[model samples]
Structures are given as C-alpha cells and as structure tokens.
Target: MSEQIETWGDLVERAGVGIGGTPSDAPVTKLISAPIPITGSDGTKDFGGCGSGCGCMPQA
Candidate 1:
C-alpha cells in the first residue's frame, strides 16, 4: 500500500486563517528571575562518562 504525504500549506488551507490580534488586557511589564543553585559529582560513574558498554580506560 502507498502512503500519502501531507504538507504545511495544505493543512493551513484546510484550517483557514485564524483571528490575528493582540489581547485587550494588561500586559506584563516586569520580569523576575530566581537562579537555582545546583551541584553534582564529576560524571565518572557509568563507564567513566564514556557511556555504558564503552571500552574506555581511565588515565593513569
């Protein structure tokens, strides 16, 4: 069986144009950010950071 491929233009044509306009409400004028501290071990757990089943040896 053959499969038919769809395109973005075809989908947009079927859906038609959408309502385009900015919301008539108050907009956010201020921004706030809180940096989170993170800590972890040096990636030398599984295969010494060489991924599982990888044949890598640690430096002497």
Candidate 2:
C-alpha cells in the first residue's frame, strides 16, 4: 500500500498521502529583474572582484 510519486500528474492523482481531499494554496515568490540597488554607502560593501588582477573590467 506504499507508493512513490515522481511527477506532478502523479501527485495530483494521489490522495490520503496528502490533505486527502482538496488542494491547498501554496506560497508565492516574486523575483526581481536585477539586484536591489544599493543606496549611497552602506558602510560595509562586498568588494567581490574578479580574481583576475589584470586591471581590466571583468566581463560580467
């Protein structure tokens, strides 16, 4: 009486293993187009620079 679900369709078909009767609302996530803009000097900053010390701008 044990089963393993491997796909979305299988998940929707199974009952009792989950809420047993109905689907519940899932949380939502909103992504940003770009990294949030940093304002002025945030005091501490990430100086993560290209490991290349060739003095040229790294190809982001």
Candidate 3:
C-alpha cells in the first residue's frame, strides 16, 4: 500500500497535477456559507446523485 502511494506521488509530481488536481496547497478560509439552512425537504426530485433516490422516498 505504501509503495502504491509512493508511485502515485511520483506521477502527480511529474505531471504537475497535485492531489485531486488542486492548483496548489493553500489555506482557504470561508467567511460566509449557506444563509438558509435545510430544515426539511421532500427530496422527491431525483438529481441523479444516487442510483435511485435520496432514500427518503421509496424507489419505483
């Protein structure tokens, strides 16, 4: 497992593509976030995020 991780690190370094394709390692701080928090949702609309549905609703 360590060997595989080392190989991946070498490629990522050569390709200049950091882990997850992130531009560079920088400390990011979020000041603001979602204003209205989700209290409840029917979640009937399927966004294709899951194979079937959000699990709150039964699958057809």
Which candidate number has the best lDDT? 3
Tell me the number of clashing residue pairs for each predicted model: 0, 0, 0
What TM-score does each of the candidates earn? 0.21, 0.21, 0.23
State, as a TM-score between 0 and 1, how close model 3 is to the true structure. 0.23
**Given candidate 1, what's the lDDT at residue 51?**
37
For candidate 3, write residues 1-60 as lDDT tens digits. 223323544556656875675434433343243333323456534433333434433334
Q: Give the number of the best model, judged by TM-score.
A: 3
Query: lDDT of each structure?
Result: 0.35, 0.41, 0.43
Q: Cα-based RMSD of the predictions, in order?
A: 16.0, 12.8, 10.4
What is the descending lDDT order? Answer: 3, 2, 1
- Residues 1-60, candidate 2, lDDT per residue (tens digit)? 346555444555554355444444432233333343322345444533334543322335
Location of the lowest summed lDDT over 10 successive residues in candidate 3: 30-39
